[model samples]
Target chain A: MTASDDFAWEPLDDVDDLEVGDRRELSLASGKLVLVMRTETGLHASCADCPHQDTPLAEGMLDGSVLTCPLHFWQWDVTTGEPLGVAELPLEIFELKQEDGRWWIGMRR
Target chain B: MIEVTVEDRAGGRTRFAARPGERLLHAGLAAGLGLPYECATGTCGSCRATVTEGDVGSLWADAPGRRVCRRPGEILMCQSAAAGGALSLKLPTAFRDRREPECRSLSGRLSSFRRFTAEIGTFSVELDEPVEHLPGQFALISAPGVEGPRAYSMTGNPSTEPRLDFLARLSGPGKLTPRLFSNALEGREVEVFGPLGRAALRPEDDRPFVAIAGGSGVAGMLSIVEAALARGHFDRHPSRLVFGLRSMEGSYLLDRLSEFVRLSGGLFRTTVAFSDEAPDPEFEAIFPDLEFTTGYVHDVVRSGLSSISADRPICFVAGPPPMVDATMRMLVVEGKVSPAEIRFDRFG
Candidate 1:
């Protein structure tokens, strides 16, 4: 594993607990972040607060790969971390993986 | 010099210097900081920030954004100036780690003034240099002698040249419109600062577009539609535009809208909704290709929601606050559309 002082791989929760197209807020030791969407494609994670105006992303609307910020309607591609129309910046994406039927997130040190 | 320290929610800090009598938002943006703002003229509360440990002064104390700032330390960054010493503040939003188009001040001259009605007019500004702005973006224009600048959306397509078109609606006498409409004001120099506003059309958006505008609010929509047509967006995805007016006399831009519809080759749909009066026979005769309905604009949109697909659809709404609010509520609550799917610019 590549060593980095900024990030670490931390187990989040059981993969079976999260349903497809549903997002859950996970409180890790590092900080509060949102585990956005388990689709047939894969799992993804991003900051809980929106990059625009700091609205909670947990309150945002998620449709498949697109996550829409509730505050300003700024849309993001959850998988690629690309901002869509009206969104100026991409959402910070965390590395996510599944092992032993449990999900893990890359948390910033 | 005033030292402004802004702390974001994620604990990121940005320090900048602000000159005396400079708006905090302006100074921050000039320094290439991603400060939150929407109507830099003190209308929208998007730029509200909290002063943690310093005194701040206001250029416009009674700004509309004040009503939305409920917290004790909260102040509209657009209206607030650092009065003295080092100022520490907290932002609800954080600056992103990305490159953004540089926004700067531009000088221009007013030309091509044509009155559409007693309450409405269309005009053009010839800039000293061409500006790059997205469709649905707006510019802030200040008349030579005016005390404050007003935000006006650029009408028609985004231009690569120095010329820009605008639609102006007279709220009443004794404002910027009077000065602009004056006969002697032609060819007068004006100061412009912008390429502002985020409710814009992106080239990458492939979803069907629905535009809802009221009166002068249609200004930005015209630019959006024009850009959409140029991109052949209508050819792939359908577009529906609904414009609302009080009566036929107050109506303008029907011919331009008709032209857009004709160019879309049956892919674009448009409707004119009149709130107070029924459609006149003579008005229908002029634009035979357009559809006319009698009702409030939001109601027309609500009634027609069934025909529009919700899958990845992008909707834009602009108008007076009440109309925009009503339309937003209908789209969110009644229509069950995701709030993210709807975009709006509310003029109070």
Candidate 2:
């Protein structure tokens, strides 16, 4: 399938008040950061960068609520973004939201 | 370098020049000889051969292949380089057509790089050549930024030429897969050495065939099913494919597998086991023909096939070390499938 080109922005009310199962993306020092709550889809998200070989997490699999590396099936839990089920190391999950239809993410603050 | 002569069971001998430090299987392959091997790094015992004459020594004492070598003269071709000169070895000698398939350096552009699950991607390489590989066999793939060559079994049948399909898993310490998919761009060239590996579907064995696979290992088993359907092997005996994954989403071949029931007129059956999650009803709705269970893969296989007392059936298994080892142990210890009938294709 071809990649999606359409972009949709949703606004979220509060960042700290966000409950489980909510996801948002915000800009940070590095770049655009994505934050996903583990309970929503029962999947974990990390830097989208494969830690072992630097593959994107976008190409991986999620099983047992764990995010498996698409390249080798190394796995991590989506809820905590902590590596689990197999392999080692945790994935970085950014805090995010949709504010007034605009996707806003939390940086360090 | 040590030179040796390999003799087939029929007394046909082929001379091979072995490298001093290279694994015997590597040397044989380099000498343009087809040597039986699965995980050429010494995990699978497919490369086991008997030393008919001369001395042989293993490079690694703790090599896992050592477990399958029983005969006084048996040694692992992947682990044992020739220690002395003028060696005579007896090939495992199966009834495979001696005309080995041509191996080509296939260059391709990676396309359709999408994640099948969290850790696996179902990708295809549009190859420059038409490569034919039997089910249960694999190809040696080389991609940019990945160290050395890594092997992956073809999920598509040999009939699909010029476009080879494969499923790759991303894990820490795994080679190549992560680098290839990460920062992906279109029109990048990837090299492939293919149509290699010997484990394949056996049309002659009329007994019920059993396939047990774990994770991406389902790639070859799925190909085996396709081959069986093409060759009418399923008409004679019902094929049972037992696949194990951590979740329903982690399993990639279920789309094709769903048609097994109708395609084989209910003769072919597929059972999937998830290690982590319970069966999803939606998944069952999509593939009503398949059976879903929550447990280890082998446990499901053992329970599901217990009633059938058929003998001399063909069993094909591929996966990680622990899963493969567990299945092999159960098949040997409980199922009592003869060693000759049990096939393994583990890379680790």
Report the number of the highest-TM-score candidate. 1
Cα deviation at B279, candidate 1, in Å, is: 1.2
The candidate maximizing DockQ is 1
> What is the Cα-based lDDT of residue B188 in candidate 2?
76
lDDT of 1: 0.81
Model 1 vs. true fold: TM:
0.74
Please give, for residues B85-188, the per-residue lDDT of candidate 2 as tens digits.
77888875432343446555678887887776768777788988778767777877767775445677788666746888887788746567776567363557
User: CA lDDT of B20 in candidate 2?
Assistant: 68
For model 2, the interface Cα RMSD in angstroms equals: 16.0
Q: Candidate 2, what DockQ?
A: 0.01
Clashing residue pairs in candidate 1, if any? Answer: none
| CA lDDT, every model vs. true structure | 0.81, 0.68
* lDDT digits (tens) for residues A1-109 of candidate 1: 6354456878786446667778887787666656557755777788887765566788767777877765566778888889886576789888776778777777767
Q: Which regions of candidate 2 are displaced past 4 Å?
A: A1-109, B1-13, B16-27, B30-36, B41-104, B183-186, B203-206
iRMSD (Å) of candidate 1? 5.5
User: Which lDDT value does model 1 have at B132?
Assistant: 81
